[model samples]
Target chain A: MSDDFERNLREHLHSEAEETREFPRRLRGRIRDGIAPRTRARMAPQLALAGALVLVAVAVLVVRNPHVIFTDVPSTIKSIFQQPTPSPTPQPFTCTDRSGGTTGASSQLSTIRTAPHDGYDRIVFEFSGQIPSYDLSRQDSATFVRDASGQPVTLDGSVGIKLVFRNTDAASGVQADAKPALISVKEIAQIGNFERVLSYGIGLASSQCVRVLELSGPARLVVDVATTASASTTAAPTPLPTQPAATDLGQFSCLDHSGGVDSGSAMQLTHVRVAHQAGFDRIVFEFAPQPGATAHLPAYTLSRQASAKFIKDPSGQPVTMRGSAGLRVVFHGASGATSYSESRDQTPNLPVVQEVAQLGDFEAVLSWGAGLSRASCLRTLELSNPTRLVIDVQTP
Target chain B: MLMDPTLGRVIERWRDGDRDAFEEVVDRYGLQLLRTARLILRDQALAEDAIQETFLKAWQRIGSLRDEDPGPWLTRIAMNESISTYRRRHRFQALTERFGRLGGGKVEVSTEARLDLAQALDRLTAEQRAAVALHYYQDLSVEDTARLLKVPVDTMKSRLKTALRRLRELTGSDEALA
Candidate 1:
């Protein structure tokens, strides 16, 4: 019976073999045409000899009468004899930090922002006062130092680095806070302060080449962590000698917004869907605005909470979700009249974003709980034309 | 294991730079190569393209032909080309689909007899499908298939067993086939 089954299976599988049985008449011709180029390429020595003869003839003529030879020779022959222009050698990237010999005034870090570019990500630390004297170093793991107590503070990710700023302090009164944004960067945290020096640990997805630049006008420190060494080609080269400008931000930067409180009326939430892409997993939130009123999606906070159950409704009740890492997405000026949710069990299984839950739509503020395999770099994008809020969480 | 003497001579002459001798090999192996590629890619146009590329590559590397019977060598090249083409096209389609430029389409089955088998094959991973094609359709031994796929013998066996079990389950679902 098994032999018969095998025979049947083979028969079924080979059923269409006959359709491709006859070799196309054009195939032999095409193969010959393809081989001809290589066959000719093999005769390069002979071709070069002939080209040299022509070049020698042109040289003799040009020496005899330079202006007459230009009128005499065909343009093609002239091009063949003319030397090929050498291509410009690309400059090797070098990291240069210009703090401009730090001002005596103490610096205050107000906000930290991250934006993803074609092949890299940029992290900007805006300061209120003088630019701080900083040291950027790659570490085996993201371990930070408390500037005030000399205690070790831990950050996320297996591999990362620390940025220690001397004579600097946090603008906010909080001692430490973790901010996770961009693709390669997992989180940025302010470890405790000690001895008037403020240290921050930058959690990276992996150890990558990082470049630091000190910008003035607003007195900010910019750190560009390359996703790949070859990523610089994806974006147009920015003319150096000047500070990295906001105009150099790629199209992906349009999704970036400062997390600020909003007063606009809420828009009705429509649908939510999860999709897995090559490098990251996406969670898209669809919204429909009230007629005759423009929908305004406020700058919302997206942070990794301690547990998936850490998210709560407006009435102050715990919301449950799947997975070990929880991402709480709070959208102000957004609400749903009728709530909708989906549980995505991906086939071939995505590395991150296991499950998503709609926590609440209470009081014109919509909130969602996303379950990730681990705490990772996350970015939010606001899209229009039927407004959508797209959140991408990177997977290692 | 004995190669046809005429085919052997043709291969030798092709290696000696007689371009016409290469056509003889093409006429002899083109259909078989296309069949093998179709088994992997499941697309006629893609199979044809793979075979054309295989022949061109074989022509260029004729000096490397060491096997007396070049059937397995040609089949291996065809399978590799087909898999690479499938992967490139799959990635392009996935990117286009993400941007909402393309829509999903059903696989076109050539005949009624192949409908069930084709559908069943589609459900298998690319590696599993390749294993089944090499072991069953091409009548290669598990060892030879493993070598062709650059996999360990035990891995190839496991893949074939899993594929056979899945195929049995699929065919068993149709009472008529069972």
Candidate 2:
């Protein structure tokens, strides 16, 4: 390594360090206000009594066993005084069960980092364990529903994003709610922590393009939302239909939007996500990579049918679902047999889309049927980076 | 180490419930701690926040201080707080790790001097940056840096060595090696 380079680094640090010379006025006042409580707590007699008892115990132990004084005194004293050090050994990582499975699988969310940049505001969530898988969706309104309590949480701002983090301990050292002091970001609050699923809601002044990414080297989930200036430039993964509901257009026909190049191995299906917006409901079929295979989506198709009946792929066994109408969704060259672990059948009974059932998971073809209340116009989108297929069903 | 009699007097008064007596120590070391935190965090506001937290912690434990000179103890707290803040904001906007290379991050360069070293230091990973800051700015020994960062001494040395290699490459000074 270059000595000049090291020299310059040292010089730069020292010179730059001189910029701030004094504590701010606010800090001094905070210190003055804080002194009283600490001083009072220090003067409490309980601690002195405890200290005396501990000394007496040590005396008796040493008298009873003199060899411990020579061999273990330093270690015993150190253990009592010092902070407990975390074990250096790492725990084996298993996928956090989506249905609120094992506590051993859950990781603590240690810190939340946020900032506003030229075109986007970023939020990075730091976790003690591996960065947990998450579900991200844009909501039509800032009205959030708490997970377990089913209480209504009205947040600030016009539009919002709802995030559900799976296998996270909600009891971690994080703020219950915060206004993230960013340029365009307005508010963020923990909606609930139910069964190891921790949910947070981010409210923004208006709708914006957003993206979520998983980063390693101290596992973090990065959420970036476009600011007003950069909204036009930041390309969304896929655009959702935001026009007024067109029940007049009537036909729930969908052109085949899900065919793609398949690699050596089929995509591994992971989680199934659902969200509700104004006039529409959406289901996201998210996938993770089968080892040695790239993260990708398979060829998929969505079609509307009159009856809530579907035949299992290859098996041809008909499965009946709820609702007056039905939607058949199929992904070719994909199988959920190995990767997908979440519940296969879901009964989320929303306004337009009521239930979803796994029609088949055989011979490299994974299929699901969406039970709809009525025939509705729907849209499909393909997104990457933890590849997902999005199906949005419009309400009549 | 011989205790400074004057510093001893100050510690005693502070232990006896004089608020300004502790604030006096803040006056002596506040700038240095801020500078150390600033080097690690790269954001002056966050550095100030770290220093404030350090001072508050020191205030709480000041009475039980085993020694007169509080420099090393205060620096240790500041290092922990700065590293904690750094882990949270590595790819943040106020000071990015020159994230343009990291795909989703952006770095804004203001001054020539800052651009030179900030870009070079940003090339180091968070662990490397902490190693360098503790070893260089806070003047901690490699063993102490390892102990504070909770790594083996050899690991600390490796991180510092890797950090220097990265800095050398960023500076285009590839002439020397050990």
Candidate 3:
């Protein structure tokens, strides 16, 4: 019966009688914007005149107070207007306080290890059940002591605290079933530039921090609060070496633009190194596996430009660029901080580059400029291979 | 704010002077608009007009829409406008017929076969009419039809089932419309 009913409806819908089912051409886009004729006709001239006035006003404002017009942008985009000047984190120093001093709190001072730098401060505390929110505003006696510069520093902004809770079985010491818990925070007070982080005690109630309500019960909670402040001249920082300005090397394909050939043939660049004296400041190369080639070039090396100069191998030896076989390029700093990585497969060709030719599977172009410091340049080129032909960046 | 990639995004883009986006929207749902309008007016030309007015109103007032789905919103507007036009035309015809009778002349009232179908339609209530329209013509499910009508699913189902039986008895057809 259902089948017959569906069949009948389909037949009725497709029959010649239903030829009128298609929407009228004249009413196509017109139907979506159902404006009344009288209002539309009347509003047209007035709207045009008003629009002209608005444009004129905008132009005049731009000519007079250009910054004001630009500043009128949404807050989300306006935040980007500030220059990214790196403000150093202040170093933490121990001091004896006359008030609010506690032996229990003093013992907990060694609980957290923070990054050593000026203008940095870190405090650690532990609690059971839900993590208690700290109210910095309540610390009215808080004051910043200057080193030698006699400059008084303030808490730069809001501090972020990491809350850690233990999860374990009570008797079995295994894992226990839990409930999803969430922490609700409210703004209690603001003192100085530091907004007090206030959290209501969850007590025995389940929190978002724990999966099992029972495990979250009587759990040891740890809170690590890190703060940053502007540097003071009292304590002189270490003198750094004078570095040269970075350069932007012009067009150069990381991978030969010519799609690589079969498994036997790999994309090869004989003499590739930093061309500093040249007009180009940076070298960007697009690479892809040879077309229809399953074979992979695990790595490649960049010899120094002086020895391997304009002829054979500039630096003499090749810096291995490898994924599975060998490491590619130079890796510096921490162990996880790799300066160079390889493409797992090929990234989808971008439409902009597709106009040139159907090239390899993916493309990677690295750029370095004269303004970029050595560390900054290395950090920028530090590619982390998360996917095929894809390298994501980790902010330092 | 995140980009509204669904109906809300389409409407937002249209509001932002992207007339081409409106055309894309039209291409996607034009037939559905006509079908929904036709259910009320039951006339192709008038349904097209209603559909046109519906889209026109949608373009103008789309900025005021806080919700995401434009389908139910557009359908409501189209249905209301079509019913308004139908009522106005019917009243005008009735008035003309009354004047003809006062002038001592027999009015030539041409009854359409569709009118007989309409009379059978009148057996059901107004809510039932909307339920039938949304279910069969608009091709909406019970839940969606309920959402469009601002009624509970069970209420909508009851209205539809009752409407179907009323229609069957009026037309004397045991065969279901589905």
Candidate with top TM-score is 1
Docking level of model 2: incorrect
TM-score of 1: 0.38
Error of 2 at B120 (Å): 2.2
Any residue pairs clashing in model 2, and if so which? A258-A300
- Native contacts recovered, in order, as a fraction for each? 0.48, 0.50, 0.29
Docking class of 3: incorrect
In model 1, where do residues sit more than 4 Å from their true spots? A1-4, A37-48, A62-396, B92-115, B171-178
Candidate 2 lDDT over B13-97, as tens digits, reads: 7778777677767756777778777877778778877887888888888766786467777877888888877777764732545
Q: Give one digit per residue, the lDDT tens place, for model 2 in A1-396.
A: 336666777777767765654455435544554454445467678879989999999899989998888879889888877975443342221111111112224677888778997677888877877776565656546778998799989888876777777668654578878887776578889998876778898888765666555665677777777676335342221233455564343322222233454554678788898778765788999887778777777877676677787765543345788997788888767888977788888989899788898988866768899888876656666788868887778764
Which candidate tops lDDT? 2
Question: How does each model score on TM-score?
Answer: 0.38, 0.34, 0.31
Per-residue alpha-carbon lDDT of candidate 3 for residues A1-396, written as tens digits (9 for 90 to 100) = 245433343344334224453445436523322332346578899999999999999899899989877666556455765656343343332111111111112111112222222233222222333332121111111123232243443332221111212121122221122111212211111112111211211111111111111112222232211112122122211122222332231112111111111233333221112222221222222233344734333232221111111110111112222111110231111111122243322222221111111111211212111111111111112112211121111111
